[model samples]
Target: MQGRLPNGTLIAVKKLSSKSCQGNKEFINEIGIITCLQHPNLVKLYGCCVDKNQLLLVYEYMENNCLADALFGRSSLKLDWQTRRKICLGIAKGLAFLHEDSAVKIIHRDIKGTNVL
Candidate 1:
């Protein structure tokens, strides 16, 4: 969901899918790990909500959306060689930070354009 903070910062809120097999356990684990991660290349987790039956994770809004949309979606944004290289480098940096630089090692099982932004 798209929302704005009181200070007017745009954000993307990800709510836990009720149909997900892993419930609160996975949510807590992700919040615990992601909260400790700090990197320029990574998406910033602003906060979360676990009130009553709601479980939502808040993230800084990405202006360009995801790589899949940029490359294939109806959006007319062109991906030149330089832009593609920059995106690739950014992804590499983010992955490197998660795998080797972060406090805990994280092996991301899903790595795809849809997941990249």
Candidate 2:
């Protein structure tokens, strides 16, 4: 779900299923990592809300949605070669930074189209 903060910042809210322990771990790990890291291409995680059973991850909303949507959506606007190249470059740079620049070496196991938002 998408929402706007009091300061008018758009955010995407990802709700985690209470029954999934793996989902819970991913949610916690994402929040912990994102709260400390800052980069231009990476999605900015604002904050998270953990109630009695529900967990919601609040992130800065990307105006264009995920890269998968831009590439494969029903939108008439098709991504050109140049735009695709730029997107790949951005993803590479972000990954490289996460691997080499951060204090902790991180590996994103779920590197798929849907996750590349």
Candidate 3:
């Protein structure tokens, strides 16, 4: 879901579903991992919430959405070859950082169209 901060910043809120396989431990791990990484290609993690039963992760909103939207015609904007190439390059750069450049060597277990933004 999309929401506005007290400071008027538009943010994306990821509320972990009750039926989701991921638990509180994994959520905390994600917060820890994302907080340590910084890259233009990677989505920014602004903050997170763990209040009683709710597990919400706040992220920087990307207006363009994700690659799945473009591929499956869910997006309004038509992507050109240049745009597609850039998307590929951006994903590659992000992976490179996670795989090599970062102090902690972390592998992204899930990499898919919907996961990329």
Which pairs, if any, clash in model 1? none
Q: Which candidate gets the maximum lDDT versus the true structure?
A: 3
The digit string of per-residue lDDT tens for model 3 on 14-110 reads 9877666777788788789788789998888888998766888899898888899988999896989998898899999999999999988879989
Q: What's the TM-score of each model vs. the native? A: 0.87, 0.84, 0.87
Candidates, ranked, TM-score: 1, 3, 2
**Stretches of model 3 off by over 4 angstroms after superposition:** 19-26
Query: For each candidate, how many residue pairs have backbone atoms clashing (under 3 Å)?
Result: 0, 0, 0
> Candidate 3 — which pairs collide?
none
Clashing residue pairs in candidate 2 (N, C-alpha, C atoms within 3 angstroms): none
* Candidate 1 Cα outliers beyond 4 Å, as residue runs: 51-53
Between 1 and 2, whose lDDT is larger?
A: 1
lDDT of each residue in 25-72, candidate 2, tens digit only: 667776797788888878888889887789888988976667777778
Candidate 2 Cα misplacement greater than 4 A, ranges: 22-30
Q: Deviation in angstroms for 55 in model 3?
A: 1.3
- After aligning candidate 1 to the native by TM-score, how far in Å is the CA of 31 from where it should be? 0.1
